[model samples]
Target: MRLPSTAHTSRPWRIHGIAPDFRVEDVWALPTPGGPDDLPHLVGQFTEGEEPGMAGSSFAYRTLFAVRRRLGRLLHLDDADGGVGGRVASLRDRLPADLLAAPRGPDSDALPFRSVYLLHDEWAAELANRTVHAVLHLGWVPDGAGGYRGQMAVLVKPNGLLGAAYLLGIKPFRYVVVYPGLLRSIGRRWQETAGRRK
Candidate 1:
């Protein structure tokens, strides 16, 4: 479900250290519930598929994503010069000493992002293109029933005026289509892991 930005900003996330300039675009309470240690399971579910959070979701989500890709390709929005390490530097280059010592989880085969750091209850990954440089941060928080649930925060730095307009244009669809579809897939994948834990 959609959450107030404070849900993420109120927490002392490591992301604050690295990308303070980036705006918090979205914060969500993922439906995956489990013990504290289950965060790895949560992360695994998200990073599992060739197209994470697409399977079992409404076809609208896939179509939106496909359209995005087609547009990006035609406009050269995701070209080599527009991506991380090209248009802008990777967040990894800005990691603090302690975060550098922390585990940098494996890069996703499914997404155009690389791990930043992994803490006991938090994991962050970064992606960038001509439009924006962004971070996906997941945190495991107490769900108030003596269990934990995942929370996701999206942080972004728009490249320029074009990036700003780009973000504005997609906000409506992201809320109405993208996030809903993603949350559904997360719940489905998380449930599949439940039986194995039995």
Candidate 2:
């Protein structure tokens, strides 16, 4: 479900230290609820965008994906030269020595993003194009009942007027059409994953 920006801002996430300038664009409480060990599965499912019960299942969600891709192509937004270490400097370059030395997670095959780093409770990946430099952050947070659930937050540094305009244009669609379906998919997958833990 869509959460208030405070849901991300209030957390003492390591992301805060790296991308302090990026705005917390969206935060959602994911459906996966398990212990700390379950995080790797969540990350695995997310990175594998073709997971049977995940996002890109519904027509609306797929349509949004198509539109986003088409828009990217038309605007030359996601070109090779527009990626990390190209148009914008990578956040990895800004990582603290410890983080730089830590094992970065597997690179995403579904998205044009590179894995930044992964820790026991958190995983972060980054993508940069013409419109913005974005970070997808996943955290395993306490559910207050002796279990952990996944939390996803998007942070972005919009490039310019075009970037700001693009974000504003997609706000309604993202909230109305995309996120609900995504959350439902995550919930279903989480249930399946949690059941298997028994």
Per-candidate TM vs. native? Answer: 0.96, 0.92
Instruction: Please identify model 2 stretches exceeding 4 Å from their true place.
Output: 49-56, 195-198
**Which of the numbered candidates is closest to the native, going by highest lDDT?**
1
Instruction: Give the 10-residue window scoring lowest on summed lDDT in candidate 1.
Output: 44-53
The sequence of per-residue lDDT tens digits that candidate 2 reaches over residues 68-96 is 88988998999988889889888888899
Which of the numbered candidates is closest to the native, going by highest TM-score? 1
Please write out the lDDT profile of model 1 over residues 1-198, one tens digit for every residue: 899999999998888988999999999999988887877777777676766768876888899999999999999999988888898888989999998998887677888888888888999999899899999999999998998899999999998899999999999999999998889888887887797554
Candidate 1 residue spans exceeding 4 A from truth: 196-198
Please report, in order, the local distance difference test score of every candidate based on alpha carbons. 0.88, 0.83
Candidate 2 whole-model C-alpha lDDT, 0 to 1: 0.83
